[model samples]
Target: MDQVPGSPQEPQDARGDDGLPGCYRHPDRPTGIRCTRCDRPICPECMVSASVGFQCPDCVRGGSGTGHAPRASVPRTIAGGTIAANPRLITMILMGINIAVFIAMTLDDGRLLGDLVMLGRTPPGYLPEGVAEGQWYRLVTAMFLHQQFAHIAFNMLSLWWLGPPLEAALGRLRFIALYLLAGLGGSALSYLLAAPSQPSLGASGAIFGLLGATAVLLRRLNYDMKPVLILLGLNLAFTFLWPHIAWQAHVGGLIVGAAVAFGMVHAPRDRRTLVQAATCAVALLAIAAVVWVRTLQLVG
Candidate 1:
């Protein structure tokens, strides 16, 4: 028989090879501690330290009617993230950054775009600039760079529309992670496919990522998917048909955004934190690999 946490008895444990009990939520994780309320095994991530023995997430949320809850239990989102009073905080910050960068570029006599735009590599005879020459920051800076008013307006509007719900659902940290990773994914793909000398700059890739995440979120919540689908379809059409558009960035961001959002919304409750962390890690590794391969191709 298993014993609850702080039990005086040293009971035999049959559930684990090491004579320890496995967590109810994550059976693979062996632990001696159990939730005081339910006497259920709990791992470190699932256990919340209290005045009494550690309580599980369920117990903490339900209060267990034993006064084990915190003074003020924080509200949670659908994705198990802490709910924010202002769901649009991250969205507004992102918009501000884009706007600030645009303003700076506009006031700088139009010379800043050359420095901020994405450039994979310059030819051997050309100046020693771009990613191959160790100017890798372009991959990031390009995401925030925009030269035209129409470009910034369209992207900022899209961010305002799509960013708040995602920021709320995934919480600030995860939402920012999704946005940044999607942008990097777009930059990497464009570097790999486009001409080394080609200059590309815009928030389109990250915004496209938001669009994909919005679609995934809608599907997860069982909301009507037709609206998002129609919107995404229209954008894809524009991506292909429009002149001077880097379709690679649009395609890459959409795929990466959808993938990260799927992981965020569909991770199992017992192992959600682990799953979300793993999902972001995997996406990051993929982006690094793409950049590495492209760097090799550009320099070689």
Candidate 2:
């Protein structure tokens, strides 16, 4: 098959019958340009513009040893070296735990209307003994137990409403710490003030703590405090007017929550963690001191 040199080559059309080249990724779509890196025809939708020229999606994404540089990392929520996609994850988990505990309590007790209440005074059940008898765990457990549907409902609603924002404002660790400390403060005050024989249980103390923290933080931001003040007043009134309500717990939680929030908002940026830790420690110590004094008085 000998051929003459410089013979005319057959003319070939780069475009298809539609007068444009079919896209490499989408055979139905037509494109006039090709990827600079891979030289693959791509439609506008599949094209990613590079500094020098355009690139196909595959080339831009560095597909299959294409040797393109990896893209920058996406933004993520990183708190104290912990990564989470959702900022409100901790708040949701706390809510779920509370609901699960309530369900378990209801199932175990066989009485939906009453029972499962934790009392400050010693009774026939476990962990109900007063602080005087060194039943300290009661302080923590009492915060999770609620008597009536309305009781848990109101408290959980408050938590759901306030928890996410507070959790976001204060990192997960700090938020959880604040919640527990406030609940402990409430229990301690209840133990000190409530009759030694009286019984009490509810998450109202923690909810009140949230409310108090919100008030303090808002005030620190120099926002108007009238709305919070009115809400606080109404809740206080309800606490006093309602029967079997533990006003002592509410007041104690409010005070401690506010104090902790104050420290959190006022601390210097360089020493925030240290100041918050110290503030929490001092608040817990104060509660313990009050309990110790009250226990001594009761024992004497």
Candidate with top TM-score is: 1
Candidate 2 structure quality by residue, lDDT tens digits, 40-119 = 66543344444434455455444322455454132111111122235467778777777777887778764431334444
lDDT of 1 by residue, 1-300 (tens): 222344323342447766677777656657677777777776544555455455665666666645435632864555667756577888999999999999999899877887878988876777537886889899999999988899899999999989986886778888999999899989988998999888878999999999999999778655567879999999999999999999999988998999998998778777888999999999999998999998887767
The whole-model lDDT of each prediction reads 0.80, 0.68
Off by over 4 Å in 1: 1-72
Q: TM-score for each prediction?
A: 0.76, 0.68
**Lowest summed lDDT window (length 10), candidate 2:** 74-83
The positional error of residue 152 in candidate 1, measured at the CA in angstroms, is 0.4
TM-score of 2: 0.68
Error of 1 at 42 (Å): 30
Clash list (residue pairs), candidate 1: none
